[model samples]
Structures are given as C-alpha cells and as structure tokens.
Target: MNNGVNVTALAVFVLFFLLVTVMGFMASRWRKADNALHLDEWGLGGRSFGTWVTWFLLGGDLYTAYTFVAVPAAVYATGAAGFFAVPYTIIAYPLVFLFLPRLWSVSRVHGYVTPADFVRGRYGSKALSLVVALTGILATMPYIALQLVGIQAVLDVLGVGGGAGSNWFVKDLPLFIAFGVLAAYTYSSGLRAPALIAFVKDALIYIVIIVAVIYIPMRLGGYGHIFDTAAQKFSTPKSPGSLILAENKQWTYATLALGSALALFMYPHSVTGVLASKSRNTVRRNMAIMPAYSLMLGLLALLGFMAIAAGVGSGVKGFNAQLSVPQLFENMFPDWFTGVAFAAIGIGALVPAAIMSIAAANLFTRNVYKEFIRPDATAADETRVAKLASLLVKVGALAFVLTMDKQAAINLQLLGGLWILQTFVSIVGGLFTRWFHHWALFAGWAAGMVYGTYQAYGIASPATKHFGGSAANIPVIGEIGYIGLTAFVLNLAVAVVLTLVLRALKAPVGTDETDPDDYGAEAGDPKTQNAPVPAAAH
Candidate 1:
C-alpha cells in the first residue's frame, strides 16, 4: 500500500459519501407519512414498499459492506473456503421463500414491528419474547461493528486515517464521522433513510464489481494467469489454504452453508426488511429475485484470487488480511476509480448499519420496553423511544469497534449467527403449528444458546485463546461441523421430546392469537385495511 495519502481517491470517496448523506436525510420526505411519529411509519417504512423497493432494500440490507470486504478478504486469506458465503447466500433464498411470506402476512395483519412481537403474540410468553429480543440486540451489535471495520479497512487503504500508532481520535476520526452521519440520518428518517440510500449503494457495488472482475484480470494477463498464480502460491508446502476444498473440509463447508442459510432470516434485520414490504407477494417476489446478489458475490470473491495474483500484502509485516482487497484496488485502479470502489465499501457500510440500528432499536422498544415496562405506551411514544434507542444502539456498536479486538468482534458476529439461529424453532415453527409448547421452545433455545456458546468459546485459533471459531467436532457423529448446526440439532431434539411429554401431561400451551387466515392476508385486504397506511398514500 502507498505510504502517502491518495488525495484523488479521498476526494472521490468524499464526493459519493456526501451524496449519500444528502439522500439519507432527504429520504424523510420521500414517502411522507401522515403520522410520521408512529412506530408503524418510523420503524417499517409504513409497511408499504412494493416489489422493486423491497428487493433493493433486502438486497442492500443483506449484502453489506462487510460482505464486500470480508468475503474477498476471506478468499485472500483462505482460498476456496471463502467461497462458502456464495453457496450459503444461494441456499438462503429458497429456504426463506418457503416461510418468509407467511411472516410478512402475519406481521402485516397484526402490525408486528419486530420478530419478538410475533413471538410474544404467537406464544403469549413474555420470557420467550424477551430472550428473542435480547438475542437480536446482542447479535446485531457486533454485526454493525463489523460494518465499521469494513469502512476502516478502506480508509486505511486510502491513507485517510492516521496510522494505528497514532492517537485514538486521529486514527478513528473518519470512521466516527461516517458513523455520526449514519446515526443522525437514521434517527431523523428511520428506515426510510436506509431504504432510499440502498439504491445508490447497490448500484455502486454492482458497477464496481463488474468493472473490477473484467478490468483487473485483463491487467493481470487474464483469468488463466490469475488462477495459475493463485494456485502456485497456495501450492507452497506451508501455505494455510488451497484453491479447492480439501476432502476433510467438506463437512465443515456444507454444514456452515446449510446452517447459515437457515439462520439468515432469523435475524431481526432480515425480518424487518420482509415486514416492511407492501404485501406477501412483494416478499415472495423479492425472494425469487434476490439471488442476483449471489452472482455478484461469486464475482467479488475472485478479487481474493486476484489479490494473490497481484501480490498484495506479499511481504508486508503484520499485514491484515482484511486490507488485501482494498489494497488490490488501490494498486490496480487509477486513483479516481479507486476512490469509487472505496466509496462503495464505505456507503455499503452505511445502508446496513442504518437498518441494523433501526431493527435493534425496534426490538428493544417493542419487545423490551413496551412489552415489559409500559404496556400502555402509545404509537407516538413507541416511535420516540425507538429513535432514542436507535442512537444508543449505534453508540454500542461504536464501542464494539473502538474498544474490542476486531477479531473478537468478528467472532461475536459468527456467534451472532449461531445465537440468532436458536430462535428458528420458535419463530418459524410457530408459523405452521402451535404443536411445540412455548416453554419447551424456550428450553430448546436455551439449550442451543448454551451449547453453542460453550463449544465456540472453547475452540482456539492462532489469534485468540477463546471464542475462536464456529465449527467443532460433533458428539456422536464424531465429524467436524458447524457448532451452530450441531447445537440446532440438539435444540430440535429437546424441543420435540419435551413437546411430546408436555402434550401428554396436558401442559397449558399458550393461546395462539393468530388464525389460519392471518398467514395469507395481503395488503389492502379488509383484514389489513386497518393496518398502517402505505407511506406513498400520504
């Protein structure tokens, strides 16, 4: 990487950053709502986005800056293992297609603002609801912090921020500026801020990826030479990775992919994107079309191999693997276009960070505060509290970035997936049938959370002593697999056994507030007419 600042790249990055900042603030007026003070308006974009809007929103929300930076970074660090993300994203849509529309339908019918709202209403259990809400907030903090890490990687490449040895304020000023802008717009405009800015973020990402995949290889003597170079590097005896999956690694790869696919929508932000759609069909349509992002992801992952071909970080001391892709762009692209790629990474961080904060805040306001503290809070009051909670959520995420080890932040994010997946039985299972007892599901979630955390905490990596990785050896199977998936198996087994015993003993299952018809309701139906008005209608 250049020791001096790339002034042209920094200028271009600032130009695009300022543009998105303006758009984020202006979004508050884009779909002006009649009662903007209501949680329905502030939290879910008035639950009125159509197919295209919902598509972009969900796309931007899921394919974040971290994915842009980390996927390639993983590839740069571990060869084909990084490609696991591509398959997992492909697997997620089909799996989600089967159930997400039902969630949207029920959420629309009942005006549920968060997944915890659905959980509380479904099982009528405050304890179960609280755990789900807390898990979401916990999982989301590290995820949001990782987005800041993505921005920092780009800033480091551009030489915008001072070096790591500098005073903390000088080192992190750019990131704090970006964070402040994101938090301010999100607080002022709520979900609309991210929804509006997502269009720009996605467009820039696609453009940069398309250009990089084409241009970078040509400059490197084509894909043939790029692959040959990458193969040669990994072929070295002491190299830690390979160009293809080793036989022993197959189980880990498959289980991680499957576990990730199942866990993707269990996240509160993913559910928030689905709930914000205009109708059940909007949710279904977006699911069908969302895989276009996977194609981009596949192309983006090649940048890792491309970085290897370009010899990025070849002999740099204590080089961070996360900076490999950013450095590659700076080395190959002209300074001005390098700024654009950096901006894509920077703005990519903003869209998801905004949505994540909003999603976590909505969880806290609805599930924790309103459900427990003040059951009689009005819509306006909920909106007010959610806005403040959004700011606090951003502050907590900033703490994760500023104070914690970056690797630890990443490990927590991995744990976030494991943590969030534990909720699948309760949220998804409750959608189809009330067969599982609420207390039994809660017990199952607790079992999965404890076992997953314990196993993850015990696994050690070269970088850390505890909480090192997500995969571990299965108990009876005696094969290596994702700890999350194994814990999930244990979770389901417990839920099933306890459910059978509880049913036989005539345990009092909580009342289900939903009817079969609620799962099929759509926008403008008489059943949903009393729901929040579409923002566009105002």
Candidate 2:
C-alpha cells in the first residue's frame, strides 16, 4: 500500500483518459443538429435526445464519481447515516416521476433553456428570475468543483501529483489540465459533451462497482465476514452502531432525503438534463427507470463497510476518509483492475463537470447577458457568449479547488444545495399555481437565503473538522437540523403573508406574462407562436 506508481497501470489510466477526452471533443458531431448554433441546439443538444441517451446522460450527471468516492468514504467513517444518500436517491425517483413530467411539458411548450426562463415568464418578474438564475449558477459551480476533487482523489491514489511543499500551482496542475479539457469540449459542444461521454462514464462505473462489490468481498473472505468485522469495529461506543438508523437520526435522515428529493429536480442542472429530452414521455420514462442508479448507490455505499472489514484505517495517519474507496481497491485488487477503477473515478468527474458548466453557462447567457446587456443578440451571439461563460465557470471552479482545502468540496456542495433549494418555493410552486405574488416571492427568497446561509455557516463536519452547511443547530430548536428545509419554511411563510397583504390592499400583482396553454404546447405549436419572446434571461 506504500508503493509508488505502477508504470503499466499508469499507462492504462492515461490511455483511457486520452480516449475519453477525444470522445468528449468529438461529441459535437454525434447527434449533429440542423443548425447547432442556437441555444436550443447547443445548450440543450437540440432538444432531441431519445430515452436511452437521456437515461445515460442524466445518470452520469446525477450519480457521479463523488458518489462513488464520498458515499463509501462516509460509510467507512460513519456507518448507516451514509446510507442516507442511497435512500434519498431511491425516494427521489418516485417524486421525480410525479413532478418532472409537468416541468418537461412546461419547458418544451415554451422552448425554455433554463428553469429561470420558465420562472421569468410564469411570474412576469425579471428580478425573481435573476435571483433563481444566479442561485443556480452559484450552486452549480461548487458541485462541479466537487467532481474535480473526485478526479483529484483518483490521481492522488494513482500517485499522479502532490508532494511536500509543492506549490498550489504545481500540486493541482493535473486537475487544471483536466478542467481545461472539460471546459474546451463544453465550450465547443455544450450539453452534447456530457451526453456522449456519459455512456462511457456509466459503463465503467457499473463495471467497477459490480466487480468491486463481488470480487473484493471474496478476496477479503465473504460478505458475511465483511459485515461481521464491520459491526465489531464500529460497535465500539464511539463508532456508528448497526447498519440501521438511530432514533435521533431518523427524522433528519428521512427529512433530508425528502427535502433533497424535492430539490434534486429543482436544480438547473437537473432541469437542463430534462429539457434536453426529445419529449415529455422521455422525461417520465427516464424518471421511472432512473432508480436503477439508486440500487447501484446502495451497492457502492456498502463498500464503506467492506473497507472497514479490510482494516482500511488501522494505521493510516492524516489520511483522507474521502479517498478510502480508491485506497481500498488499490490494496485489494490487481494492479490492472485498480487502474481501471481509478480511471472510472477520474473520467466520472469529467462527464458531469462538463454538463454542469454548460448548464450554468447557459443560464448566465440567456438570463443575464441577453436580458440586461445585449437585447439584440442573435442565436450565434448567445452561443458564443455561453461558450465563453462556460470557460469562466470552469476556471472559477478550478480556483476554488486550488485555493481552498480539497475537503472543502464536500462542504461547499452541501452549501450549494441549500442555496438552490430556497428557489423551490417560487420556481416549482409557481409552475402549478399563480397564487403567490411575484414581488412577495422575491422578498421571501431573500429572507430564506439569508437564514439558510447563517445556519450553514454554523454547521460543523468531522470531514472538515470545521463549520460547514446542510444541517444546522437551530438555537431554540436545541439541536442540529437541515438548513434548507428550515429556510424553505420561512420562505413559504413570508410569501403567504405578503400575498395576503397585497390582496387586501388591492396592490397590483403584475400581469401574467405567459398564458396557461403555453405550458402544454410544443415549440412549433400555434399557441406559443405569437406569445412575446421572453425578454429576460438568467
């Protein structure tokens, strides 16, 4: 386990990296659209992805390398609580099955590229859409940065980079190079980059997980031995007990899963994935089937227990718990198989990082640039701006990876989810009902965002051993709780109160910018033909 790089294994890893990089750049031609220059084409793969393609694309985008590394790592450290991720994902598919079809219908009917675009039209408020767009872009950047960290962990395991006193620039050079390639293909191909590369990413992930879950257990003795050893080790007073929920954690676990399930489809990146589908049925069918990824997640989380049985932490010092899976495989598997698993983690990072950057860039271009800066921008002009914005977003994420501690990715991602979840009350709720006034919604969003940040800043994680986000200890509530859910409650209360006040005062609630039927019409349908093109972007 103290060994340096294996040259043959290193070669395999590099070869696969180059192959995937080529595949990523070549994606622009895979499903070449008629024009390929418009936002609808470039930002959303021409809105023409079939069921299988979207299944892979979204699977790749959502169940990421971070899941592969971090979930097991969590299990290695904490036990059953880590399985929170698995149940959350499984619960999510059922909820997505219910909500995403409505979203897809509304998006396609209006030719929406970003959810904030739909929000703008539905609420008739540029300010509200701007907030949602900015939140999406901000939240997405940290998630992309986490993907980079996933790749970084694989490289560190492969003995690629980093050493004592290595400058930040030198330590992270490989990550920067990886980010550069991702940013390039995303700039050229947008959503198509991840769409094409997702096939490879998911295939490798499945192969590695199936092999690891079965192969590693036999190597370590048997599945029963793995669980028995894990129980013995963790059953110590300080360890996370039994592979089941403790009573205190059950509420938080269930609520986190439910809240995250609600917030998952609300993410702009999630919406970007849905909007790229060819039809509403594609979205629904994909949701119905996507829980297969959750099953994979369950298998992956068990690796943490396997790692424990392997005595993964017996003597290691200052070791990253996050890197436990990679190290476990490196110690247990043959060199060649280890190489393949590492590459799976590395390439897994690239797929979603590309898609996330593309999604965030599209939001900035359509919602911010065209809305405020260049009202006369053409299709070509918007695509070019989006391409450039994609690069900036990647560079920003790279800056985050380098300047902050590597472990910051986990905390930042939780913070990002909390920030974006605040948008749900306005964006998701507004799609079904116009009951909430636009001005009131904006005010509520502002209040919720502040409360969410304050709570997140107060959270502490053993991973960082510092203050972080996701769950917070509310003062009067007297214990740690989920920040996003708390803030969302505040947001709803404010919106309701302000709406009633406005109704009583007979204040102008602003005219609806979109008609009801527009939510159900296809792009070329007569209903949307004469409706004013949305004047605001992100």
Candidate 3:
C-alpha cells in the first residue's frame, strides 16, 4: 500500500462523488409529478417507474455496497462458504417472481405504500400491522449500517479516514459527512434521488467488477495461480477455511442459502422497489432479468480469491479482512482507477441506504404514525412525516455504525435477515390465503422473534460474545443450520397450530378488505388508477 494518501485516486473518487451528489439533488425534477408532496409521489416516486428504470432501481437497491464489499470480505475470510450469497441471490429471484407481481397488483389496487399496509388491509388487525411495521424498521437499521460500513472500508483504504485509534470524532467525521449528504438528498428528493442515482451506481459497479475479474487475474499470473494461492492459504492446518465447502458445513451452507432466498424480498426495501414499478408486468419483467445480477455476484466473489493471491491481508497485524478487496485494488490497479473502484463502493452505499431509510420511514408513517398517532393525517402530512422519519432512520443507522462491530458487513445484514424473516409467515402467507388467524399470526411472529433473537445472541465468534453469527444447532434435528430458517419453521408451526385452535374455538378472524379481482389489477385499470389511498382504521 502507499505510505500516504493516494492523491490521484482520491481526486477521481471525489470527482465521481460530486457528480452523484449533483444528480441526487436534481432527481426531484427527473420525473416531475403534478404534486410531489403526496406520499405516493415522494415515497414511491409516483409509483410510475417502467421496466428499465425499475430494473436499475431494484438492481441498485438489492445489489448494495454490502454486496461489493462484504460478500468478497466474507469470501476473503472464510473461503468457499462466502459464496453462499451467490446461490441465495439466484434462488431469491425465482422465488420472488412468484409472489411479487401479486403484491404489486394488490398494492396498486389499494394504493398500499408498504408491506405493512398490505398486512393492515389484509388481516384488519392493527396489532398485526404494528408488529410487521416495527419489525421492518428494526431489521432495516443494521442493514443500513452495513452500507455505511462498506463506504467506511473504502475511505479507510483511500487513506481519507484517520486510523482506528484516532479520536472518535476524527475517525468518524468522513462517515458522518457521507451520511449527511445521503440524508439531505433523500429527504429532499425522496425515492427519486436513489432511482435516478442507481443508473450511475449500477453502471460503475458493472464496469469495476468486469474489469477487476479480467484485469486483476492477468496481473496475478492467471486464475490457476489465484485458486492455488487461495487453496494453500485455506489449507494451512489451523485455518478453518477451505477452497471448497467442507462436508460438515454443507448443512449450514444449504440452510443459509435457502433461508436467505426466502427472506430477501421480505425486506421492506425490496418490496418498496417492486411497489414503485408502474405495473405488474414491469415487476415480472424485472424479476426475470434480475438474475443477471447473480451472475455478476459470482464474478464478484472471485475477487476474494484474487485478494488472497494478491496477499492483501498477509502479515498485517490485526488486519480487518473486510479491507482485502479494497486493498487489493490499491495494490494492483493504477491510482486513478483505484479511485473509480472506491467511488463504485461509495455510491453503492448511497443508493440502498437512501432506499432503506425511505422504506423504514414509509412503514413508520403508514403503520405507526398514521394508524396510532394520527389517523387523520392527509396525503401531504404522510409525506412530510415520512420525510422526517427517513432522516431519523438514517440517524439510527449511523448510530449502529458508530457503536457496533464493523468486522464484516455480511454478518450485520444476516443479523437483520434473522429478525426480518420472522415476518414472512405474515406477509407472504397473507398474500396466498387468509387461513391464518390474525392473532395466531401474531403469536407466531412473537415466538419467532423471541427464538431468533435468543439464538443469535448465544452465537459467539472470536470477534464478540453475543449475536456473533447467524448459524446454530437446529432443534430436534440436531444438525447445525441457519437460525433464521429454524425460527421461520417454528413460526410456521406456531401459526398453523394456533390457527386450528382459534378456528375450533370460533375466535374472531379479522376481515380481509381485498377481493380476488384486486390481485389481478394492473396499472391502467380503473380499479387501480382510481383506488383511494388507504386510510387508518378509526
């Protein structure tokens, strides 16, 4: 690494940063609406994005800075096991293809701004909707924090941030500045900011990854030498890694992949992307093409092996494995190109962080604030509250980054997936049927949240004592697996059993306001275009 600042690279990084910052502020005018003050316009970009726009928006939202920094970081640290992300993403697109269009149709017909809105309308239980909304907001905090962590990794390698031992203010000032810029643009332009910026973010990422996979290998002799070096590193007798999955970890690998696939679209931000599309066909078309990102993710994961070959973290005392890919770029690429790579990671952070805060804000405004605090809130009021809430959400995420471990961005996200997955039975199950008693679904969600949190808390890694990992021993089966999937199973069981008991006792099951036709509604249909904005139950 360079002994001091990489001036050429830092200049290039700053230039791209300024360009995106300009674009972010200008996005409020990109697709100008009649009245931009309504929640539908500000929070969902007027729910009018077409296939290509939605494609890039979803691409930017789903394939985040975490994908760029953390996935390879995990591969750099744990060898082949890190590649679980690749398969899980592939699995996720196919799974979402089945349900997302249904969600879009229903959301369009009712003007539902959030998944929690659908839960509110579907189950007619304020309590159930409240839990779903709170879970989404809670789970999103750490996920947003992971994005900031990704940006921090880039800044650290660029020699912009002070060392780990510096005063906290000195160390974190750069992150705070980035956070401020993101919050300002998001608050000002709302979803339009990220939607517009995603085009630039996705293009830079594709360019950087494509170049890295090809250019870095030729500089490292070839893929043959790269794989050999990675294998030899993992083969060191004390190392707990391997060039391939170990037989003992196969269950963990498979479970994590399957569990993650199930939970991916369950995230409020993911659903927000789908709901923002102009039509159900746009959503379906995007899903079919979304797997292209999975292919990029596969190539991106190879950077881990390339980092190993490049000796990125070798012999550095107490090195953060998260820095492997960034350091590798600095070591191998020219300073100017290194700046571009850093910008890709930096802007990658902005796009999703903006969307996540907006999603969390929408949940809070529609479910918590409107339903409980102010049922009389108008469309303009909802948008204003959501905008403010978005700022607060980013503040909370910044706190997470300031306080929590930044050892690996992937672990932070998995920790969130564990909590967010608990809502799947409520949201996804509600989509297909209302067979679940609202109260029973509540019971199931509560049970899953308690169990998932407890299991994750007891998992200890070398880095910390609690919530250190996402895997643990599967109950009864006694095999190790993902805690999230295990909790999801228990959630399903509780909901199913309680539903039967509730039915036998003749307990009240809340009304579902939607009709069968609502699920088939499209953008220009009278039912969809004329649908009234959902109001909170009095």
Q: What are the per-residue Cα lDDT tens digits for candidate 3 across 1-538?
A: 5546789999999999999999999999999877777888889998999999999999999999878987888898899999999999989988988889999999999889999999999999999999999999988988898899889888888898776577999988989889999999999999999999999999999999999999999999999999999999999998868888999899999999999999999899999999999999999999999999999999999999999999997888778888888899999999999999999999999999999999999999999999999998888888889999999999988987888667444456677898899999999998899899999999999999999989988888888777789899999999999999999999999999999999999998788999988888888899987887533322
Model 2, residue 353: C-alpha shift (Å): 0.4
lDDT of 2 at 390: 89
Please give the distance, in angstroms, between residue 499's alpha carbon in candidate 2 and its true position after superposition.
1.2
Tens digits of lDDT, candidate 2, 1-538: 4447666667878888898889888988888877776888788997889999999999988888898899999888878878888877888888778667777777776667898888887888889989999999989998988998898888787777757577877877888788878888888877988898889889999999999998999888999999888778777886655566677776677667777877787777888999888877788889988989988999999999988888876777766788889989888888888888888888888988888888898999999999889989987789889989989999999888878887677787887877888898887787778889888999899998998887777666665554454776544765556778788888888999999998888877755766677556554566535433433333
Highest TM-score: which candidate?
Answer: 1
TM-scores for every candidate against the unseen true structure: 0.98, 0.94, 0.97
- Number of clashes recorded per candidate: 0, 4, 0
The deviation in Å at residue 156 for candidate 1 is 0.7
Q: Model 2: which ten-residue window has the lowest total lDDT?
A: 529-538
Q: What is the lDDT of residue 59 in candidate 1?
A: 86
Model 1 per-residue lDDT tens digits across residues 1-538:
7877999999999999999999999999989988898878888998879898898899889999999988998898889888999999999999999999899888888888899999998999999999999999989999999999999889888897676678999988998999899989998999999999999999999999999999999999999999999999889998889998898889999999999999999988999999989888988899999999999999999999999999999998778889998999999999999999999999999999999999999999999899889998878888899999999999998988999889999899999999999999999998898889988998999999999999999999988999998999989988899999999999999999999999999999777788899988878688888765433321
Give the clashing pairs for model 2.
Answer: 366-537, 367-537, 367-538, 459-468
Q: Which 10 consecutive residues of model 3 have the lowest summed lDDT?
A: 529-538
RMSD of each candidate relative to the true structure: 1.8, 2.8, 2.1
Candidates 1 and 2: which is better by TM-score? 1
